[model samples]
Structure formats: structure tokens, C-alpha cells
Target: MESTAKQDPTAFKRIEFLVVTKNAELLSVSKDLVEHYKFRAEYSDSVDTVDADTRLSSSPMMILISLEEIEGLQERMKNLQQLRAAFPRSHIVAMVAGDESTDDCEMLRGSGARYLVLLQEIKNSSKLYYLAALLVQGTYIPVPVSDLFPSTQVNFNAYHKLVLNQKFLPVIFSGFTFSDKKYRQLETAQQVYVRREELGEYRKYIETYHDQVGAALKKRCRVMMMSLMALYSEILLLLSLDCEAGKKDLVQSKVSEFVQGSQDLGRYLKDCPDVWNVIAKALDFQFCRYERGPYILAYAVYISLKADWGQMQDVVMTALLADLGILDLTPESFKTLQKKNEKHLKPEELERYRHHPMNSLNRVMLRELEVSNETKSSIVCTHERNDLKGFPNQSPADKIPAEAQLIHFCELLDRRVRASLEDGILTHDFVRKQVWEEEKDSLKRFNAAFLDKIEKVLVA
Candidate 1:
């Protein structure tokens, strides 16, 4: 390690820190802190992987270490001692287990730890931020950061779903108010995504009420939805592993869970437009270009529109199973084919691709999942356009059901958004106006009322 006496005055003002731990959750949040708040950060997975001299070479102003048992008590203490000896001037915030006692906390503190937080605090962003701020300012005490939040949550007054948030559509999509096509735009967008206000737009809707009852309900809804997504991913992975031998009961059971649970969640989100809209947006954005993306997006769109629970379930069922017929195609190859213009494909290949809707419907029927006639119609008509431009069958605008129209609109919107994210750059003003134009233009080919409903429930 370099001599500390030669350090310049300006060097003292520039704070950098090293975090040592293998905890994914901790590492993730720490990274968020570093990027969003502009902190200097370095990471080491475990004490053994790094030497004290190497750790101190950079002369970080602080060190953040976790309490997960590493080689036992004495060895862990020895590691801490080495870090303290190497950088005597730096602070160490040791994340201890939740079950740690006052004595244990004091012992770690006595062993050169400057601050302490319970392991559970890692999940609470607010607490993490509070602690980080305190430590940076050289004001944090060696005590646990627990029960810091007020019993009542802050009011959900971030923005109006049907009005205010529409202004931030492009910002929400890419986190910046600049065109993603430019270098600066992409860089800024990534940083801007973590701003509290940006997150507030989504959180305000997800949590419409700040009261205890509303909070409890919100937690339940979020957890259930996450579980449903996990189930979908698991099912997709299993099917891919062995299409014939995939666990049918598991898939059916998980599907049943999502369907049954959605009834209550659907009703809960009916009046909370922002909550469900963001939920749908996130589901579509994160999972797009994958097998389950469309399904989750359809489910989100259905609930956001305040459709009946039974009807929404049918939409989800169709969405999840709609692409099943094309499962045999390699994803890479399928994506490549999709990238090509329709006119470039051979007639037989185009015909084969177009028949996937019917194939999906047939596959679900073979599974004997008790799908409704309405669900069957949705599945078969997923590719049908209101302007008679769709493949397999070209149904007129009036003939397409509102349900099918909603699914189609969502599907197209996700594809377009993903494309923009990849190929173009946009700011809030640019994207909002663009979305409005596109939605208005869509009226020529889609049902006016259906398009209006979509814009109101989603974009607005």
C-alpha cells in the first residue's frame, strides 16, 4: 500500500468505497447507489479473494462489508482487522445478520466496524439510502437501521394517471428526455431512470392509497403478480427443456393460481389506473422478444382496461398459449425471420408462420385445459387485424372483438416500444406526441372506440 502522508488535500474530499460481500441483493443496491447518487465504488465478493494491501492500494475513504459468516468467527474478525489496519482512516459499515444481538453488534463495532445495519435493511431502499448518506457525511453511528420508516407510508400524490404521467411516457420508456439514438441520450437515460420522481410515476399508481389497508393490499397484489411471472418463466424453461415431457400439472397448477389470484387483483386495480398501467408497461418492456412477454403484456392490458376477471383470465390464457405452436422454431432463427420484410419470405414459409394462431389454439385444446369459447376466439384471432391486414384471416374492423383489439394493440405497442428502444432515441415530449399520433392514426384501421379505450387506459 502507498504511504498515506503524501496524500494531497483534494484527495481527502474525493470519497471512494469498497464493498466486500457475495450477497447479490446487497451488491445490486450498492450499485444502484453508486450510479444514481454518483458515489465512487469497488466490489470484492469475499475477504479471501482480496488482500489487504491490494484493497488499500486505492486508499478508499470507506469499506462496506456484510456479516455473512466467512470461514467462521475468528477468521472473519481477522479479515476485518486486516482491512482496518490497511486503511486506518476509512470507515467500515458492516451489514450484520438480523438475529445478531446487541453484544454481537458491539463486538463487530469494537473490532473496527464504524456502522452497522441488520441484513433485512438491505431490502429497504430508504433505509439503505439514509445509512449511506450518513456514512458519506461522516456522521453515521454504529447502530442498526431498522424501523426507520413511519408507520404510515408517504401519500401517493406523485401524479394523475390519466393526465400527468402521460407527459413522462418517453422518459419512462428510456429514462431520459433525449433521443436514445445519440450517445449522450443513452448514457443520460440510464442515470435518469433511478431518479425518485421517475420511479414515483410508477409507484404512485401501484400504490394509490397510503393507508394501512391500501399498503397491505398493494403488497399482496405485487407479490402475487411476481409469483405469476415466476411461474410463467419456469413453465417456459421446462417446456423448452422437453416439450413433450414438461410438467403439465405444474403448468396447469401455476396457470390456475394466476387466473384465480387475478380475479381479486383485477378488481383491486380497476380504479388504480397508474398502478396497473405501469405494471403492464414493466411486464411488456422487460419480457418483450421472449415467449412469455406477450402473455404478461396481455394480462396487464386486460386488467388496466378494467375488464371482467373471467374474461381477463381468458386473454392471459390465450396470450401465454398463443405462441406455443411456434415453439419448435429456434428463438434466434424465429427472431431473424421476423426481422425480414414479409414480402421476402417464401409463400410456404409465410403460410406456415401465419398458421401459428390456429396451431396454438389446437395445442391448448389437446391439453384439455377447459378454455372458454371466448378464449378460443381470442387465440385464433390474435393475428387478425381490424383493417383486414392481418395474416391467416383478414377480419373487418367491426368484426374484431374489443378483447381481441385490446390484445392486438398491446402486442403491437410492445413491439414498437422495443424497436424504438433498440433503434431510436426519444424524450418525453417527443414520444408522447409520437404515441398520440400513432394512436390517432390507428383509428383508421382499428375500432375508434377500442383505440380510444387503449389510449385512455394505457398511454394516458
Candidate 2:
């Protein structure tokens, strides 16, 4: 038989946070911490609060010990071992100050600390409580704790130095949701997929122009573009190697970051024409190096024309990565690789040329970027036409994603512009008439709505 008197379960079942710090003021949870984690916290200078009390033992407990504030470091570490022995289930989070040495970080781990965090960096950090929860669940972090939390600090900004520049790479690589195994797979995948010389040449060209641009916004945008190239190049390269199976989350994470980076840059791109010009021109020249000149030209269509910011991002990424497989194919005789079936080529060669859509699809779908289904479809449907004459999987009208139609129009515009340029048609008026004619004629093949929108944006 059981006896109960109007039970209040949550009163006894609250999550407890034990913070060991000399300064109660510093230990007090910030608004971000409070709002994100609703744990009932207790502040104390000693680690004795980690005892197996009835309530704490029944619920989850996180004991955050500040190494900087505590005295007699050796004795404190000895006490930490005893405390861990006492409460075998609790997470012992060693909170060191930012200026601590790397050896100190290793020492904390050796002293039975499951988690090591810098208290100075934890004010409003999103990853703090996340690591806390993972530690409690016995998460396996593949890298050393020191790698996750690098030591020392700097403020090397022009005015007061930039805040984000210091921890940029650490924050980026560490904040992702992949496990250690998956991260290694991703790194290895990039190594195998990217052709070293081509990627190196592209990176060098971009780096040179980016340095020449000399604007902070342009430099940032260049980073995003470089990252985009690295990502797409790897995705395609991985597909060519037949090693991208079962790494969905890893691939999706990169794609998600790429999209996020593109969207983030859209904010700076809104009213800054000079900044946009620098970035677009750099992308154009870089793509020209690899014979995918249409790649960036398609992207420039979005900036040169008026379109929705969201739609602009969709088209920009679609245009950038649609022909990713072309990186592997050295198109020496590759005049007009855009068309589904080139009349000048033999049947088998044309078939091989047409295989790029499949290669593009294979690379993109398996690697799984957190892009829209429409975006993925746009990539595969790169060769599709409104006349119902596309190859592989001739997606009829209305079957294609909206962005595919947008990309189709842009691809056509870029191809025609290139044709005019290569033909030595130097007059600006001739090229403008050429673009305007193509845009007007493309209403049937590409969607009419995008044509109408970009037609207004087309300047001679």
C-alpha cells in the first residue's frame, strides 16, 4: 500500500546546478542562461555541494567548478576525484578562465573532469548548457577537450579589434551537430573529392582579388564564396569516389552552413552595389578559370536584376552549384556544354556531356545539405526545358521546382551573353539587345513570371 498527500512532483524533481565560484556576482546566471536552462541553481565556493542528497541524487546535477577562483589547485583537484567518487552520476564541469594554459586543460581532464569550459566565454554562449546536457548523457567527444576550448584571448580589432575574428574557426567547427566519426569522414571526404591543383588555383585567384577588393564586406563575401566552392567541390568529389553513402547528417550540415552563409551575406548585399559588384566580379572571374563561366554569371543575374531576397539566395546557390560535376570534366573541346544535346558532338560524347546532370544529382542528393527540396530538384533539373525535351528524367511542366525555372532562365541568359562575347561582338548595344531578345524569347521555355521580373532588371 502507498500513501500520498496531494503530491507535488516537480517540487522534488527540479534540475539542480551547482556552481563553485569565489564571486557570487559572476556565478549568477545571465539572462540567456536563465531563459535557456530553467535549472534551480545553487552557488558555493566549495565542491561539497555535489553530495548525493535525496533530491540531487534523484534528479540530474551539473557541478560547474571554477579553477581560477579556487585556491590550492592540487588539493582542489584531489577533492574533485573524491567528489566524483561520491556522486558517480554527476557531470564535473571544470570552468577555467580564458588565459589558462593548454597543459592546465589537460590536467583538468586527467583529474576526472568530464567537461572543461572557460567561464569568461560562457556569459551568453549557446553551447554551454548543450555541452552540459551531453556530458550528463555520457557523450563521446572525439577531439581533445582542449581542441574544443582553445586557450588565451585577443582583441585585434581596428577600433577595439573585432570580437568574432578571434574564435571564428573554433566556434564554427565546434558548434555543429556531427559526431567525431562523422566529422572525420567529412574532412576525409573533402581530401579525396577536390582536385588539388584546380581547387588551389581557384583559391589563389579568389584570395588575390579578395585582397584587392579591400572592403570588409567584400572580404567576408569572398569567404562565403570560397566556402561554397570547397563544399560543392567536395560533395561532387565524394560522389565521384562512391564514398558519400550513409553520411547524410554530415553532408546536410555543410549545405546548411552554406545556405546560412549565403542568407547572412544577403543582409550586407541589400543596398551595397559596390560591395555586390566586387563579390560578383570575383566569382565571375574564378568560374571562368574552370570553364564554368556561366556559373557565376547566372548568380550575377540575381544581383543585376530586381528579385526577392529569398528567391535571390535560392537562385544564387542553384546557379553556383548546378554544374558542380563539370569541375571533374576538363572541357577542352567543351563548347556549349550547357545544352542537353549538342549537335556538334558524337552521340556517346553528347551522352557523356548529358551525364553531368546525373553527376550533379548524385553529388548533391546523397551529401544532403539542409536546402529546400526545390533547390535539390533545381540542381538535378539543370538541363530541363519547358518544351518537355529534357533528358534522363524529363520533368514535364509544373513538375520542376520554382527555383529550377528561375535557374533555367538565368542559365539561358548567361549562355547567350557568353556566345555574344566569344563571337567578338564588342558593342555594348549588341549584347544588351542579345540579352533582351533572349529574355523575351525565353518566356515559353523558362517560366514567364521570372522572365517578366528579370526583363525589367536587364540593362544593355
Candidate 3:
């Protein structure tokens, strides 16, 4: 014959418990039970008028109720039935102090109470906590008297059914607002999705907020200017990279794209004068120096003519793209070149160095960037000297295009200022004086019309 010995009723483990009772002694008993069970627990002291709204939202693993405190068993049963409806699988343990009538026990048992612990068995704190823990763990402990209370052996089928029906919609939508209530309602797994959704929503919210603030808004314009300044700082860092390894080309290409994209974005804002004003503010913030000041003014002209003169736009775009080539040159190579004696270079090496601007121009042409024949002519003449001393065709003043002459002057000014700053020359006024002393005569050779624009932007 097979052995028919029953398993120990209290040998199960529980994780979390919620105790609900009006009696302070019962609350104490429940707390003691939770501790003995080796489980984490929380409790509500006012069971008769307990805030079910808050408790239900809390969604604890198990609820413990004292049966002796119920004045009307039927109403309490209806309320418990509703709670079971909301949280189907949650364990409900009812504590009974004395021997009850069969009807009373049956009433409590029918009302979704999974366990009816007798007062005598729970005299010690350890046993009560252990029982509560077991209830929370969802372990099926046999009722002390199964024949008298068959319904005490609750199943998790109702809870699983409710969960399947609800899906996970509540957790998904709760992330938009930052609230403690929202946080508490979600489990750890659910919170992960909430956080991801919140990030995406936050990005969109900020973008919309910026649009609503308008381009003329001083605060909004300041932020845009600050962001562009940061981008320029990143550009400076990228410009310092090694070009021989080909990494410089990659950085230059990215910068070129950024410039092109920003120009295109500016075109879209032309109809919105307020937005255009903001972009102008950003430009003013970025090009505060004499060298950058010319390029800034030129860029403003290019943007202004984007809609009116297609050919001019193409020319300006090409000139903008050409700046990337200079950016692609290694800082170390530039420094070494600056230190070398220009007079010592043999004819062949000097010839090669003279064609560096043309080499850059060819690369841009090969990329098929939007540029006109006039623009290409301008780009080729960027290095030509007015005194007929510059190379790659040693063109005289009349042969050089006005746009190219202006760009050449701007480029030289930028290089000189940058070189002086790197050498720890602190004062801009001193740097300007030194640069003017060296290049004042050469700069005078620039086309009168082109020079006037440069002077207005830089000198005025």
C-alpha cells in the first residue's frame, strides 16, 4: 500500500502581504505574522472605512482581513466580491478568534477568503507572520479542516484571467505625467516601457515648446545661439585631427553637410521674419571676431539671395563647401608649414604648395557640389595675388573674380587670427594691429566693391 501522509500545512514560502483590520491588536497580530513568515508586508489599520481607492491602486500581493469586525456579513461579502473582481488573484486571509457558527464560517469562506486562521493557532507572532507570508507566496496550504471550509483553497485562475483581459495598457499611458501615483501603479517590468516612452515624448514636447516660444523670443534665440556656439566648438576640435590618416576628410564631410543643412533650414525660415531674426542673432553670437565676422556677413548675403538669385546661391554654397577642405588639413601639417621658410622651397615643391587651393577646388568639383562656372572661376582664383606674386597661374588683380578675392582675404584674416590666438596672443586689438601691419597693402589690392562689403562688416 502507498503511504497517505499529508504534507506540512505551513511549509510554504510567501513574498509580500497587505494586512487590513480595524483592531489595533489584529493589526499587531498581522504584522507579527508577516515577520514570522519571513516576508515583506504593509498594512491598513482602518478596515471598516479603509480607502479602497488607494489600496486597490497600491495592488498588494495579498490582503488579510479580520472576520470578527464585520457588522453586516452580506454587505462585506459584496464588497469582497467586488475586490475579487478587480484583483482576482490576490490572496485574502480571514482571521477568526473563536469557534464560529457553520453559517458564519461558510459566509466568510464563500466571500473569497482563501484562508481562515483560528486565533489559537496564531497566538505567537512567528506563526502569524509565517501564515501571511505563505498566503502572499500563493502556496496552497491545506485548510485546517477541509470538510468544513472547502472554498478556502483559492485558485489563481481568476487573477490570471483578469490580467490577460486588461493586457498592459495602464502602464503604457501613465508615463506622460511625472507623478508618484503613476510610479506606484507600475511594476518594475512595466516601468521600463514607461521610461522609454517618456524619453520619446519629452523630445517631441521640447521641440513643440520651442516652436510655440517663437523665433523672436529672446530666451529661445539665446538657446539657439548657445547650441550653435557648442557646434562651432566641436568643429574646432574636429579641425585639430590628423588628415593623413583620412579621418580629417570624414570630419570635413560631416561639417560640410551641417553647413548645407543649416543653410537650407534658413531658406525655409525666410517667410517667418521672426525666425529669421533669431537665426541672425545666432550668427551674431558665433562670429564675434573680425576674421569670422566677414564670413558671417557673406553667409548672411548668401542666405538673403537664396530665393532671389539662384546663381549667387550656388556660388555662395560652393564657397561655403570649400571651407571644409581647409578644415580637413591637419593642424600639425599647417603648423609645420607655417614654421618652414617659404623662400627655401624648391620650384617643384613651391609649385605644389601654390596649387593646394586648386587641389581643394578640384575635390569639391569632383563631388559635383552645386556650383556655377563663375563660382568655379572664383574658387580657382582664391590664392591668386593682386601683385601677380601668387600661384597656380599667377593671375593679376583684374583676372581674379570679386567673390574669390573677398573669400581669399577672409581666409587669410581667419588664419592669421587663429595662428596668433594659438601662440597665446591674448589681446584681440594687438592681434588686429599685427595682422593689419603685415597684410594692409596686400588687402588693398582686393576689388573695390568686394572690399567695401568686407570693410562694412569688419571695420564698421
Error of 1 at 143 (Å): 25
lDDT, model 3: 0.45
Which lDDT tens digits does candidate 1 get at residues 1-460?
1122234444322335577888888787777656544565567777566544445344455678886756556666777887788767567777766555556655776788766655554553134443454344322111111101222233212211113111111222323222324334334232211222123233343344333244445443543454444445444333332222324787677677656655555555554434533343333222223433433543454444453322566666665666655544422234334454345656765677788777667666665556778888777777787568885678776666555665665565555555555565743334434654676786544666665655544455
**Model 2 regions more than 4 Å off:** 1-224, 243-249, 274-280, 283-288, 291-305, 309-317, 324-343, 367-371, 416-433, 442-444
Clashing pairs in 1: 179-425, 179-426, 180-425, 205-275, 206-275
- lDDT at residue 390 of model 1 (Cα atoms): 84
- In the range 1-460, model 3's lDDT, one tens digit per residue, is 1111112254322224566667677765665444434444555553445444334443445677776676677856765675566556566767775556667666876878755665443442123443343334322211111011111221111111123222212322322333454344432233221111122232233233445334323333333333333333334333321111224565566556545544533443444434423433333321232114224323444333532322444445445544434333322222234344336556655555566567557655554444567777776777787777776788878888766665566555555545565576544445445544456545644545454444433332
* lDDT accuracy of residue 408 in candidate 3: 68
lDDT of each: 0.51, 0.48, 0.45
What is the C-alpha RMSD, rounded to one decimal, of candidate 2?
22.8
Candidate 2's residue-wise lDDT over 15-35, tens digit each? 345556665534554223433
- The lDDT-based order of candidates, best leading, equals 1, 2, 3
lDDT of 2 at 111: 79
Residue range with the least summed lDDT across 10 consecutive positions in model 2:
152-161
